[model samples]
Target: MAALRQMQTEFNNVANRLVAQWRLEDGDAWAVIVAAAVAMLLWLTPHA
Candidate 1:
């Protein structure tokens, strides 16, 4: 029982870390792409 609990804790920790990292990476990439697109649009559109 104790071993199973320990294994479960470890698994949960690993899963949390993976999820956090994946989210950070995905968010960063999306932000970069969106920023680049907005920059391009601003550059292309003329403002008086």
Candidate 2:
């Protein structure tokens, strides 16, 4: 009961901080680079 509530609050606080940090960073170029890397890896790797 009380433990569950405490866990939920802590989770919310951690999630909010992560969201704030993510929002503060430059995400556009990072997203494009990540996508390109993933595509390259997929293209180069043998089918499994």
Quantify all predictions' global Cα lDDT against the true fold. Answer: 0.61, 0.59
TM-score of 1: 0.48
Best by lDDT: 1
Q: Where is model 2 poorest over a 10-residue stretch in terms of lDDT?
A: 39-48
Predicted candidate 1 versus true structure: per-residue lDDT over 1-48, tens digit per residue: 676567557756665665566785887655655675577557645731
* Candidate 2 local lDDT, 1-30, one digit each (tens): 676567557756665565566775647545
Model 1 regions more than 4 Å off: 24-48
Score every model by TM-score: 0.48, 0.49
**Candidate 2, TM-score vs. the true structure?**
0.49
Q: How accurate is candidate 2 locally (lDDT)?
A: 0.59
Find the 10 residues in a row with the least total lDDT in model 1. Answer: 39-48
